[model samples]
Target: PPLFRRYQVNVLVDHSESKGAPVVYEDHPTYNNLIGRIEHIAQMGALVTDFNLIKPGALHRANGGYLILDARQLLLQPYAWDGLKRALRSREVRIESLSQVLSLVSTVSLEPEPIPLDVKVVLIGERLLYYLLYQLDPDFGELFKVEADFNEEIPRTPENNLLYARLIGTIARKEGLRPFDRGAVARVIEHSARMADDAEKLSIHLLSTADLLREADYWAGVAGNGVVTADDVQRAIDAQIHRADRLRELVQEEIKRGTILIDTTGERVGQVNGLSVIQLGNFAFGRPNRITARVRLGKGEVVDIEREVELGGPIHSKGVLILSGFLGARYAAERPLSLSASLVFEQSYSGVEGDSASLAELCALLSSLAEVPIRQSLAVTGSVNQHGEVQAIGGVNEKIEGFFDVCKTRGLTGEQGVIIPATNVQHLMLRQDVIEAVKAGQFHIYPVQTVDQGIELLTGIPAGERDEEGNFPEGSINQLVEARLIELAEKQRAFAAPRKEAGGEEEEIKEEEGGDERTE
Candidate 1:
């Protein structure tokens, strides 16, 4: 009970009610607001000042305790950081008017004795601001020597998970909300892992978790339920999505209206659905773009149209370059890569960023080179390396659900599914309906570890292995790509052969003409 009593904390400086040890949260830490200012009072006509004229500020109230300041807000305010630093360094909070600081005050002002600044200043900010201050301001490093790093996630062990559920219960009770049933608590923990995007970890974002619990409790009250159940939590989650999913709806509408070309069911050569995530503020969702590739005879150059026009970020460019490496290592070890290919995200006007779409791009390029058709019913999201290994990516859940929603909007064919990196399978905390569909064979999720695995899934053909001579089996995708490259090389040599003969003929005729002129 005593420990529980310790949780009963007082709110200080909440609209100027300073009780107990005053802890200040300076949201707008202006120079005058952070340090106390002097005021002028007119006594009988002339300006006069007394000890009562001195107004205390955040630093004055937070003395002998803690002063919480947002580093971003502090720096944004003019001279606020410098003034705060001076007080901390001198161990005193000074009271002075801005007019006095600027020498604009002609009348006398009260210069109160500086109070001892004994409060601990806690600067909360992102990692960038901390590093910038450490590198740019030497004073920042001297004053702020200790650094406490808070990870976004904690290990999801059984004991930790139980503790997390208990923490949620504690918050619910503190907020005067209905108790969460066992199922609701378990769902919240699972949602925590989903937010962390990891199966073995849970997010420690208490504020967000509390918000979810509060919303679930509200839904429980609306349903006249005494306790919050799993259904209430689901409703709260769905309502949150419904509230913030306007952009997602518009994107889906565009797809349905045929403005954004995405094929939910079909088979096409040199085309595949590439899944990407679009984040607007705190809300993020997945979008499917049609990535296409065209092959021609030239030097081995896979031209990324996005990168050429500076629409691709560095990671996207690197992923495309890795495709070239995969092609050379897999098919063109002995011969020059005498083929030029161009890849583009069809109908996508915005700049493309991550390599999560690289797997789809590679599939499109392979289908073009091999004359194979990729099933357009399936969409893919993954990053690839030079070794043809598929890697994990962020927003795996959104990407899968994005494609699922689109497919559901049109019609959920049994063949319509998504292929994600095998490593991302642990991150699958999908909706109940989706899980049910997968169980009923109405949808599928193929976890692929390598490019070959993904290609086999996409093309329904065996990605055959090489034999004794390091050549792929006949009619395999790799064999077809190699054969196409060899044909292009031969054609390149053939075209150059006639050019060489024509140049020789022109030189010989010029020599003959010079001799005729000499004879004349």
Candidate 2:
């Protein structure tokens, strides 16, 4: 009768103060935090527990509604994933002590009855993690049946542009920032396209767009304007770049001071400027690398020094091999390829990747073979195939601006320009300064479809096509290169002829000696 009078009851889930179903987001989904835990209290130097010490977990609180979690965090916690899966499978939450679950300690503990679960669970993560779980975890598909995919960018159609402008207005209002004028909206849309790195698409990365809007608002306030103007947005964008470009500035400084030798004028045989993009976190910038080639007479072997030294990635090595294929197919189809050439990225101490520099390397090799000088003022970026077709590369905008910055520092002559794949023409979202310079005839951007077009642009010589009889035009770059290859092949044959005759004479002397031995 006394124990019955002192009985206690614990309320784990209380919704008396709420009107709707509860929704919970568990930031840290540990084992005990996912499934309810029976907590113990230490009394008089001894551990003690009771029914009143029971604590409700996220599952209990979110019962009858919804629960959200970060997939990465759930996987990182010990037993958290298993506990969530167990609850989902059984449609109920069970509370148990950690020691009880592991059988580490079995003195005594209360096991609360399971609570019925009616909540829907949602996990947010990258596509990579989702794919990993779908492949590795058999239960993942059963639990997460529906999927929603979000695009990083949307097509930059006129209708979409209007919708994007409306989205910008919504963000401004929600953030309590100054309203953007029509010109300001247009500028923001242009910036979105730049962020997407496609002139025909706009980035939908809401966080970045929101940040830009907030920064523009701050600049607008500083300018004492009630509404954000295009000038303010431009200032904001410039300020953002200025903040993240310390490394880029240091690289440019090295080039400006001549510490890193990059030629911006004149011409040199077997040398061309190549562009590469360096991405650091949210900032990406391009720099020009001096790619040079040297050739001599030998059994045809085109060597990539970077690959030999283990400083080149597989893709870069593949590009070098492709160069050899192009040369053999174009110049040595009827004869043996007799040229030995080596390509290197001068002053490149770090690892090199990507096939974007293949076009530049090929051009440099052609220059060395033909003894033609390529203009140092021009840089090239693109991937080339065995057929000599130039393919588009990533980061075209950054590559162009990179060379333009270097040339601007050294005084841009009318001859300074960059040759890009003609297909990449649709991706040009250049900076205003560079665009102005192009309009003023101080700088240029040339898009080419084939290696011939690129080579002809790099060197002021014609890239002569093969006639029906398979002869290149005289004095043309191709003619020079083919003639050089033919000469090397002839020299190789001449050297082999003398060795063959000497071997024949030795064999005759051996035969005479053997005949004398037979007579004896």
Candidate 3:
């Protein structure tokens, strides 16, 4: 006894459910948006409502499924986060608009029955948002017991490379775009690694890669190619660079037009080029700044011009202070360091921050004191401690490439180079052309561990250490700095001696005058 000859099932995804998932991405997540709001109809100049007029919100529609919310958006809305928590905790959704909850509306509204909730709430946001919720909202921990952390990059292995090629193939087929050949896939993977800022890892930003693929496909079609080739991928990358590089070009233009004074072919005593990375939106580029130092006879202090005008950040100020400490410890242990050094980034009008230039600043200060010429063919980056040891810095690749580009513009003299901390060698994932230049002796990279090593490389002079009698070796850079500091101290003493003598004479004359007046 069959109940029916044929049976069929009809399943409909809520039209609002994006990407064919029962998940709701609450972009604005207002109280009325997260919970249902009651609609009203004006009849005879009065408000009226019915059960059919009740509109369901995200919570109602996402019942028995997953509800995705951006924690930042949810918190930005007034009472929306708390309302969502209440629903999740109570396992029921009460349709209450913000006006009703705040008692702002005087007109009558329908009170829809609460719908039982049985759905998983997933919050997608930064780590700061999650930490804030855990610290501020007690129920957040109880509700979100499970956490899924995503890595920014994945390891670049043969297996992963094959998988990534397959992913690109699938995307190309799905989007009805020209297929990418092996060379194009390889180039894209290399670009992905560059995006991650690591040679060993590939970026997980699939959307960005997909966009690149589509653009490459368009260029391939324009060139009348049947498939996307490596040249197409390279052109797409070049176009992206051309589009987002206006500011970089302007900076380079300023450098070339003599608006920003950076020498690429000579040597100066108290100047060195320092590297810094500027982030504009999602694009970041590095530029070299001319850091100069002037030293004179005064109390031992390193005056940071950027900090004086409030352009330098706390870390930069700290680095300058550490420069003072290093001078005191290394050169002034026995004699008073009667030197005042002023450091400035020449021609920089905007706010300058970061301690990555500390090494360059110290090199400039030392050059000013020792009167040793630092090669303009070279630029330097890294932070230095009180012990004068070079420390690693961020954006090693960008910093190196920045100076390289500036030098390349002026023509690579085969002697141009950049000195970086030795520890940062592992982080080197430079461009192929730069690598070729290095290999062909058109450019160079010097890795230094201590201030001694860096100073030697910068000035082509040895930074001699103290002997058994605490005296620097004859004719060394350190000896010259020490001798200069001694001369300044002697000059300071001579100047103060005359001032003290004049003051004593005035006191004696005042006493004699008082005695003569009393006698009269």
Candidate 4:
């Protein structure tokens, strides 16, 4: 459902769940009258407070039953948790100047009507909310003992999808519309999959569904159609594009003018492609990658790399493991080695998290060590394992587009492109400019299922075949990495072993001590 519709539903559900004290407005006597001055209600040992008058204003009025709150909104309120907890524990609801915490408003002690405290409180919010609460608040376990998490999309089984389509039809009818074309329903399901962040379930989130339906309405009205059709959905998307026309216009103007460098013609040494994720609200854009690293191998197999400098995320830890694993397996498979490598997101400044850039880091490191030039055009993201497979990641679209935006702004000369996981292709819905660029042969997006594929794409050369023994060609990156790891492992063992004495100094010391003892 839409946000507003959801609010309406909550109200209906709350009332249905109870015959409680009525919802009082700010001016209602139950609320307007001072708690201390209330002789009638207070005399019954039921007193309300004004402490949380700011939020949970609904909480006080509907105190005897359920108090529904959005977890995100509650967290946004300053001291909201403490205030709510106080009210629940005191079994008293308060009305007060919302400024009690931050302002100079005097804290008013109100009548302590036992917060009947039996009302079931339901908090609706993102899944992250639960994790945040548990991680930050030690007292959370005591308060919210029971959690009922709602699924965004219900399972998209035959029965469920059929009912979901019926639900969509029901929504269309409620809008005073005729119906929807079957394909339009399928589009909704596709969108639902995107919204739910899953494939198995056909459940598109209610909020997203409501928005799409509303947008579909606008398009239907435009087309003068009695029944909303797929055309209407496409029209809505177009309408949204029009709204963003201004941004697109500026970017395109810049691209045409050649103010930015987006083409991949000038390949640089010690650099590999990577992806960056740019999140705007619930929508995200992925940009193509550029990772540059300067590396020096030392005595042990450890990759001492700072993430903030290399990948730009707040130390996700995975980045470190990735680089270490690649180095251990490829460079020094037989030994540990010390290494100093500094990797950087060549053009990134903000929007951080994840060691997803670790694969790119490894690529850069190997390129630097082998003195090979990575393809300037192909940027890569995804955490690589010891076996060199390209893993799937979130914000794939954002990372792709962010790079694309930079490249496009510079100039996509048909060969300008990025390489990502093959699984990410379905998520590709390019913006108008990007789609146009692709159509015009100005840009490209290639997906790879394996590291060899990614490396081949990035280097613009075939990654050589492995021998019968599963060894890469001697001069290949794999060989360089293996040699390095083996050297590091040997260094680690040598350092770990006890050192041999140069002149048996301990024996001389023992003899001197024995002579001293005889003299004594």
TM per candidate? 0.92, 0.95, 0.89, 0.65
Number of the top-ranking candidate, with lDDT as the measure:
2
Candidate 1 residue-wise lDDT, 49-81, digit = tens: 555456678987788788999999999988788
Error of 2 at 322 (Å): 1.2
Task: Looking at model 2, report the run of 10 residues with the lowest lDDT sum.
Answer: 1-10
RMSD, every candidate, angstroms: 6.6, 2.2, 5.2, 10.4
Model 2 scores what on Cα lDDT? 0.94
Worst 10 residues of 1 by lDDT: 6-15
If both were scored by lDDT, which would come out higher, candidate 3 or candidate 4? 3
**Whole-model Cα lDDT of every candidate shown, in order:** 0.89, 0.94, 0.88, 0.62
Residue 381: error of model 2 in Å?
Answer: 0.3
lDDT by residue for model 2 (223-290), tens: 99999999999999999999999999999999999998899898999999999999989989999999
Candidate 4 residue spans exceeding 4 A from truth:
1-144, 197-203, 241-260, 265-268, 295-311, 335-340, 401-417, 422-450, 460-471, 480-520
lDDT (10s digit) by residue, model 3, range 1-520: 2233134322222555355447666677888888877777888998876665577778877887788988888888889888988998999989877788889976677787788888888999999888888998788899999998888799989999899899899999998999899999999999988888777889979899999999999899899999999999999988987899899999888888888888887899999988899888877788999999999989987899999999889999999999999999988888888999999998888888779999999999999999999999999999999999999988888889888988888899899999999988867878778999999999999999999999999999999988998889998999999899999999999999999999999999999999999999
Better of 2 and 3 by TM-score: 2
Ranking by lDDT: 2, 1, 3, 4
How many clashing pairs per prediction, in order? 0, 0, 0, 59
Candidate 2 at 24: error in angstroms? 2.9
Candidate 1 clash total? 0
